[model samples]
Target: MQHTNILIISDIEGSSLCRDYESTTFLGRGWPRACLGMSKDVNAVVRALYNAGAREVTVQDFHRTGFNIFPEIIDKRARVVQGYRQGPVPGIGRAHGATGLVMTGMHAPSGADAILAHTLTSRIARLEVNGRLMTEAELFCASLAPFGLVPLFISGCPTACDYAANAIDGLTSFPLHQEIRGSEARAMTWREQMAAAAAAALKSPAGRPFNPKGPFEAKVTLRKGSGEAQKLAARWNLEAHGPQVTIQARDLNRIYLELVRLVYLNRFTQHVLPPGLFLYRIMGRLGLAWIRRQLKNLPPSLR
Candidate 1:
């Protein structure tokens, strides 16, 4: 494990204190608090990685808008990548010699009865590759394969942990309970427990890169009555049946980028995406600053 470097991909739905759809998006009633909790949860793991002798740790904010975690609260030792990026790997660039990846705040794929379950976007009912339901953890792990990075660990809801464990051999998963039925004092222990478990899992990590069989077929089923499928199919020149659109590719990375384009971009937007992403990054920073201001204005008891 000498000179080990770890990459952490963080999402909102599986953050320690995030509980519902509302908490997963900006300006939702619980969004600010959720962001704070996510920061502390990630900070604990950052400390643990460093203590475990990791030479470098990089965190990618993989959730919506990619601006969820509060940088001020995260461990300064780790490099944090905010917002989205475009490349062969999509939001995840090349592994850049990182030894392994650690995904935090992950959730189950769409159609699962897990906390805030969805893949890529809630607009899509589900995403399937080679007839099997897809999860972000699986996609992220597969994206890093060309760079020789394996999945070291994951922490999230039970369903999410199970999906990742089943998909990648020898991957260590820590599941935070879906519900904590007790006093707030009792409920607050999950973060500490998660930190300890994650640290323990990384003490001696073992796993191979996830390389799913390709010549892939992907089915994107948009939610019923959403009227999005038709628009997307028309935009991409793909055929749509009812609410489902199908995509085929020769490899996982190609399929992954296709899914990204399906969910986030169209022909016109693709042309202006660079500028759009820049503006979005600015908006994300402003949104986070606003959240910080709101938190500061709250009474100390609530804070």
Candidate 2:
């Protein structure tokens, strides 16, 4: 059975070109190239999904500014969703009619040994749910559960893939090793293998949506002093323990939104969210234009 609409959530930390913090940051010189690598990775999977009988594909740029993917480079058949949205999920808006989801260019959660490892924010020392270290893949899956979308495929660093697979049983994943960067030939081979595997996962579409039963407990450990944690705890009315703050909620979706608030918002920002988002959208357009110019000057292989 062909999934009518499939969503591919793309990040940057696990993309082939991302080597460190500089590669993942929007202002860094390597960021444009990193975006190109990510766009290519997403396009490969998008093409594979189309060939595997998917009727429609949606690619959501889920990196820092949500403007990393070069829309001009990805498969035209896929609708690209960019920038942040104020919602339960925060970034990607509604699930629409998507029956399944794929995660690519994802990295390991906070406290992991993967390159550019961090949860929602670098300030987060660690994030735990039900005593287990939680991953963004798990959180994304749970947030989309109400839409009845199952996690179909994931491609990322070894640690990320392993954690995602463990979180969602029977989910398929491709681990793009660090050694692949040693040569262009190896990178191409890795992309081919990942695309084929992603297609197969979409065709089979195994497992159910990750809707773990709750009352859920989220423990967020900050990297620095307890002051920040105490402030956030007081603001959210959560429990602050040392440098950590704990949130309890009956729904995973709620927990996700709260986590977003913790990572990206404050009292002043929260009140001015609409204007802030508008400003961000304008900035994103300018940044994207700059990236276009950079891409044009680069060689075909890099683009």
Candidate 3:
């Protein structure tokens, strides 16, 4: 049977970017756990695509530092792109060229007040382009639209699901948990979510993505202590706060590249992690972490 070239953009290991978790605010923490489960999520998606007549499955380990996808656990046939610095930067089409794509363990844009509401950094107060709100996931997915690649499946916490369903069409989601207050409240087991994801993904097909023109308004508000605001302002005149700066972009990828550069600078000034990472691996870590935690919590009978 021939396999389709399906790319899964994951941010499981990226859940720590929220910096809200008691465990992962610090760099290099909580990523290993997320990567393990992200590997399985990749497998589950691959299982479905292979069963549904896919030819290839490539999972982008899009999370922190961008290189956390554990190749040992991921299906040997699937390709994993890890880390941000080593990637084309997280934006649409960066993961394009696939027959179809899946965005797993995603979250809402930093503009909205979802649990971890920050685009690139908590330092970023907000990201707006041409009066529309923008999140890293949205920017990343929108980037894919230009490549004519459709995102078919997405999984993560409820917020992640809600974000994907609203942003990308024909994209189904597997919501792992509902956040109440701060901690995980109503959660779905990883196996259950994966099973459900596989079952729900059976009927999906590729759809057109959002490919809009730029020179669009781009704005970002940074957190206190992050000079990213001024640095970004120097690039383009938009807006600035004590810890924020906004810019306008004629190119989405251009803006994305700018963000990537800024993030690297931030890391250099702060915590030192891996050197080369890609787009897919950075975000996959976050959602994958949530998925695996459920698997660990599963009762023996359930397993």
Top TM-score prediction, candidate number: 2
Instruction: Estimate TM-scores for all models.
Output: 0.92, 0.94, 0.70
Which window of ten consecutive residues has the lowest lDDT sum in model 2? 180-189
> 113, model 3: CA deviation in Å?
2.6
| lDDT tens readout by residue for model 2, 1-303 | 446579999998888777678878776887777787888889888998898888899999998778888887788898999887776566776788898889999888888867777888899989888787778888888889888888888888888899889879668999889887423456677887898998888765457888878898988998885998998889878899999999898977778888988878888998998789878877777777887788789778655
Cα lDDT tens digits, model 3, 1-303, are: 121677777765223112234323323344334444455566666666666666677777665545545566765767765544333534322554575667766665667767655666656666676675676666676666656566666666566567657756676766655432112221224544564665456456545555556686565656543466666655544466656565556877667666655544453532443432233354556645554565476444432
Ranking by lDDT: 2, 1, 3
Candidates ranked by TM-score, best first? 2, 1, 3
In angstroms, the error of model 3 at 282 is: 15
By how many angstroms RMSD does model 3 differ from the true structure? Answer: 6.3
Deviation in Å, model 1, residue 4 alpha carbon: 1.5
Which 10-residue span in candidate 3 carries the lowest summed lDDT?
179-188
Candidate 1: residue 112 lDDT (0-100): 80
TM-score of decoy 1: 0.92
